[model samples]
Target: MRFATYLHDGVTHAGVVGDDGLHALPDGATVLGLVRNGLPTALAQGTRALRSPAVPIERVRLLPPLDPPTVRDFVAFEEHVEGVVASVGDGAGVVPEWYEAPTFYFTNPYALVGAHDDVPVPPGSRLFDFELEVAAVIGHDGTSLTPAEARDAIFGYTILNDWSARDLQRREMKVDLGPAKGKDSATTLGPWLVTADELEPFRDGDGFLAPAMRVSVNGREIGHDLLSNMGWPFEDLVSYASRGTWVRAGDVLGSGTCGNGGCLAELWGRGRPVPALAPGDVVEMTVEGLGTIRNTVVAGVDLPPVAPARPRPRKRAR
Candidate 1:
């Protein structure tokens, strides 16, 4: 089932997406509510609402599938890491630690967006960029779950566009810590959430999904890849994340950028010279079994002039 959260008549609602329109969810009010309660039960009930009066899906303004309590983005693709390190001249290959565990970082949930929304180009971010990926929404809560069990906890999947400020990211990453000011701006998810059941047909005997993923800017295709190539699968990432901690409902996990050229940085590394997003530029991504997410760029809050770098202090004698 394709589920979506949308605004209508000044009210926000969650429902099942249908050919004619959207079917209201009776027992569960919102996507998050359904995830926390019981996604399967809520979905079953939602199917019956197909007969009820539904507003045409196209007319309503969509919101992020859920208001997640926490959003964790994991680096699962070695191709993406290799491309980034190459582009930035990081002088290192995929680390051994990356292969040992699925490392992730928590992002600001308040920075969420939906399809067709206007994304702001952060002030002073002349090197703005986008990362194409997918996000998994947790349906049931669990801790220290095995990979098999983790699969059952997954509620659905959706497209994720992690907006980036490349210049800021480079300057901050030199500190050897994780991305902060570089990535706090915003992230786009949705258009619609495709439930796990809906994607089962694409899974192979090994339970892996081999779907073609692609990204485009202003209707021109830039990068494409297959989801099955990730070094760490979504199941592994979820199970690893659940270790010694609770993976609760409405906690979202993102499959970091899919391939070598999913972002402009990678393209630039490969000598493509792709320009950064500008006002009115539309960026779109499509993943098999999921859907597409398209957004427009706009100017955001302006910042004060950047201060010049301070002089380095002389070494102190011990």
Candidate 2:
């Protein structure tokens, strides 16, 4: 079943996507809340709602599918890693050790954005970029799980766009420290959370998810990559993350950026600065089976006006 969060008549609601329209859930409820209660509860409630004839999906604005308790983005695509390295001319390739263990970064839960919301370009950012990715939502809570067990723990999948401010990222990385200003602004995800059962047919012979992903800027296609290119599968990454750490339901695990120049840094030379995003730019990212996410860049917070300086009364006193 496809699940989503949406806004209608100025109220946010959780719902299941149906052929006719949205099947709205009860007030003060969410997809994440349903997942935490376990799939049986979710399925039972969701299926019942879906059968209702009163709900209208077309009247609502789709939000991100999962309200994650925590979000961990993993770098598991070797093609993306290699492409980034080549763009920077750092001569750095995917290390053998990277495959030995899963590597991920923690993201701010509060920065989560809905599927059709505007993405605010961070203030002072001159280099804004987009990444096309696939992320999974965890269903079961556990630790030290094996790869086989990890697969069963997956609740569903969604498309994600890991937006970046490349200039800020480079400056911050020079300090070899926190993600701070580099990635804190926003991450766009979801039009729907497609259940694991629905995606089973797409799993390849290599046991990897093989969704087709594409990214476009202002209606022009820029990048295309296959989800099957990841070096570490979702099970491997989940199991690795669960080692010495507890992974609970509603937690999101990203498949990192895809290859074939998904971002500007990879497509254009890193040394040559690119045009900054303006107030009207639109970025659209899509993954097959999972729906598309389109975000418009709007002017950020308004700045306070500069006050006129007081008359120079201090000049005589000095």
Candidate 3:
């Protein structure tokens, strides 16, 4: 079943998407609460509630499908890594260590925005870019889960765009440590959260999940890749992320960026930096079996600058 968190009549709601429309969950409850309450039990209760006549998908504004307590985005796609490394002249081929272990970073849960929302270009930012990715939502809570078990712990998957500010990133990475400020501003997620059971057919072909993914800007297809191309799969990433940390329901794990030059930074050398997105520029990202998330870029309103303090008179020397 596909699930979503949406705003209707100024209130946020959790519901399951159906052929007719959305079937709303109970009042004051959220997708996170359902997951934390255990997938089986939650599904049982939610499934029943979805049959109500009052709930309809057309009347709501879709938000991120789940409200994660924490979000960990992993660089599990070697194509993206290699492309980035090549862009920075950091050598070719996958870094061997990346395969042996999963590498990830944290994103603020509060920064998440729903599909179709306007993504504001931060003031003073001239180098904004978009990354196409797939993220997993955790269901079972555990620490140090094995790869096999980790697969079962996943609740579902959703699309994510790790919007980046190249200028800010470059300055910070010079310290050789973080991708923080550059990435923290915003992370776009959702259209719907698809359940694990719904994805079983796609996984059946090769006993692994390999969805076709693509992205476009202003109706021009720019990048595409298959989930099969990932160097480290979701299960491996889950195992690594859970090694010493507890992963609970509503926690998110992203599959980093995909290949085929999803962002302009990879397609064109960052020599001049990609043009800043302006109001009315539509960006669309899609994954097979899942849906498309379309966002329009809007120029943010500039805040008034603070006035400079007046200079004080020099004190007399004694």
Q: Give Cα-based local distance difference scores for all models.
A: 0.84, 0.81, 0.80
Candidate that would win on lDDT: 1
Residue-by-residue lDDT tens digits, candidate 3, 240-300:
8999878888899999998776676666443434464567888999998778899988886
Q: How would you encode candidate 2's per-residue C-alpha lDDT over 1-318 as one tens digit per residue?
A: 888988888988888888888888777889989888887888898999887664575567777887798999988777777666555334466667777777888988788787778988776676777778899999989999999999999989998888777777776666666355667788887988888888888889999989888988788787898889888889998998999889999999999888786777675543434455567888898888887889888876655544666877566553
TM-scores of the candidates in the order shown? 0.93, 0.89, 0.89
| Every model: Cα RMSD to truth | 2.9, 6.0, 4.5
Off by more than 4 A, model 1: 306-318
Candidate 1 structure lDDT: 0.84
Error of 3 at 50 (Å): 2.8
User: Model 1: per-residue lDDT, tens digit, 1-318?
Assistant: 887888878878888888888877774488888777787676776777777788987788889888999999987888888777766547486777888878899888999998878999877888899999888889899999999899988988888888988888888789888787778788998988888888777776666777788999999998998877777778888998999999999889999888857888877766677888888889989999887888999988888977988997787875
Model 2 lDDT at residue 146:
93
Question: Which window of ten consecutive residues has the lowest lDDT sum in model 1?
Answer: 85-94
Where is the poorest 10-residue window by lDDT in model 2? 268-277
Model 2: residue 245 alpha-carbon error in angstroms = 1.2
